[model samples]
Target: MTKLLFLVADGMGDWPVAELGGRTPLEAAPTPNMDALARRCVAGTARTVPQGMAPGSDVANMSLMGFDPAAHHTGRGPIEAAAQGLELDPDDLVWRLNLVRVAGHGPGDAMLDYSSGHIDTGRSTPLVEDLQAHLGDAVFSFVPGIQYRHLLVQRGGARAPEAALDIRPPHDITGQPQGPDLERFASSPRLAELRRAAARRLEAPANTTQANAIWPWGQGRPLLLPAFRQTFGLRGAVVSAVDLVRGLGRASGMEVAEVPGATGLLDTNYQGKVDAALEFLARGGDFVFLHVEAPDECGHSGVTADKVEAVRRFDERIVGPVVRALQGEDAALLLTCDHFTPLARRTHTPDPVPFLLHHPRLADHALPAFSEAGAAATGLTLERGHDLLPHVLERLRG
Candidate 1:
């Protein structure tokens, strides 16, 4: 049997920037390990986002994990809720309530920060608790999650005119006026009232990232997924610091590995995640899905150098160690990004991202490096991201 190691560098793809002489962050970063692997691995591009779908991490990730988003994804809210062990009723409505920083108390103000300065869990928890205490009742409840991400669920089959509302992801509209989006939901009196109440009650404490309001989007009911083992005929494990990834793993019947000091940030515990992936494989697991979120966060902040640094760190700290450990072992390793989080746009795009698949038995068709430019130059592209897994399986078993 061929052991599998699937690694994902979230939002690592970027557009060319003038500062880097028109090279994307991945191209600019000095990723020697990735470059070496590219020399011996199959390099190509894969379109993780389907047509007409939002290029959010949830949709992209689902596609990367070999599930067709159109067939399986309900919404991000339900997937995140699943990560927190929250069971949803058939009629329960779950929405992702992001702690955000707006310019003013009124909706007319611009969204200053989508993640409320990437609010720490300690500071954001109290606010979520307070909201639950003050605003939560029989119909609505607030559930705290990692950092700025949280959940708001509406029970009793109370629909909130979601179809009529123009709710948008806070990250997608950062630095833009939010009044128009808020006004679109004015038809739903209950939602409007809840929004005002949340804004009035939540205030950021001094000297901390300002999480002054809750921006709700990505609403949906719960969903069920076919087990990963049944779908792929391989027992799998998932390692990630983010809830959405962990939730997807749990929902798909994969073991969710937790690593200490894993913060899902630039300073996250890269060694710990590497250790977990190796440990899972050592324990007779068939596959491991390791995800790193730092690159995407850096892209969202529009920091080019930081994004480059993130890619380098992923290449050195995570990919290098895993590649070294797999030496002399019958394993197939795959490294790729789910989608492009371009620093220029400071948001996700539906463009195809680069992927590298390596196996000891296969011949090397080396490239100069594993990057957007190099991958595109190869002209080997997977039109659908979901096809990647099947392709990997074929290479492993062929």
Candidate 2:
């Protein structure tokens, strides 16, 4: 029997009614299919990790993929670097820099639009290519994102773990959170000079990215771990439109299954994703990792209606096909978010995410469709996210 299908929506933060103008996008949205599945399936809130921890891509993803974030965690740069085929030596220091636009001059109001003025690949790609040419060997390469974010892979060899280079992350409504141990690393005089050099190169007029300058952040290296399949004893493949999810698949020693023209939009190839999942099943995959980026994108832009529509589209286009495939099959199914990315908050939230498990022989309960409000009432209440994998494994073993 096949294991299960794991569908994750990354950076899905939570917001209260007042904060979101009387409805969090997930609560306000019409997710008829998801709600229905939740009613009959095991469902409830699950914490991805502890609150007030450093908001990180790798840590969150590690938890979602059924690994302990504390033991298996690494930096986001290593994952992206691996995904892009950049092999790194153990001595190299890497940072994942987002090329964002910086507005205003002074200290506070300087960083513009956290996302580099909502960059598109067309306008931003050339600038990224040009910067690599001018900077030469000191700087490595930049990977344009499926979303507006860009990846800057630096060439820091032989630098001590406590070097002076610092990351300038986005998030200052209250105050910028310091990265774990990065400040101390940035304190050394030699490392500080290197940091200054990197900053100068980024700020220099000679470089023209057309999306403003880069805001370097999330500095760390690879945290190696056993492959997910090896640890869990399940064969899996990841199907995603976004590069980061695909990158995660690569890190976990899984195939990055492609869905043609999957644009990460509500109007993207939804049917195409469904087809991809079926294809993965045909190719002998016991588990499939799927990701949709639209809801998170709309939340980041604070577009409530749009985010709701994205959720609905996932229901009609993606969920239905997956459910249909499960009919009469031995395969089980699981769906949940990586984290909350509320429209009002415009960032990843620490709140528990709603999750569901569906199988043919499970108890009869009717979840109308997928929505935050209904999920609260679903019979299955999980206390933590890590519980999901073992539970699914047990169900599969049955």
Best-performing candidate as measured by TM-score: 1
**Model 2 error, position 188 (Å):** 7.8
Which ten residues in a row are the worst by lDDT in model 1?
156-165
Residue 322 lDDT in candidate 1 = 93
TM-score of model 1 relative to the true fold?
0.97
Instruction: Give the per-residue lDDT digits (tens) of candidate 2, residues 258-297.
Output: 7777776666787877788788888888888888877776
Off by over 4 Å in 1: 156-160, 204-209
Which residue pairs in candidate 1 collide? Answer: none
- lDDT for model 1, please: 0.87
Tell me how far the alpha carbon of residue 317 in candidate 1 is from the true structure, in angstroms, after superposition: 0.4
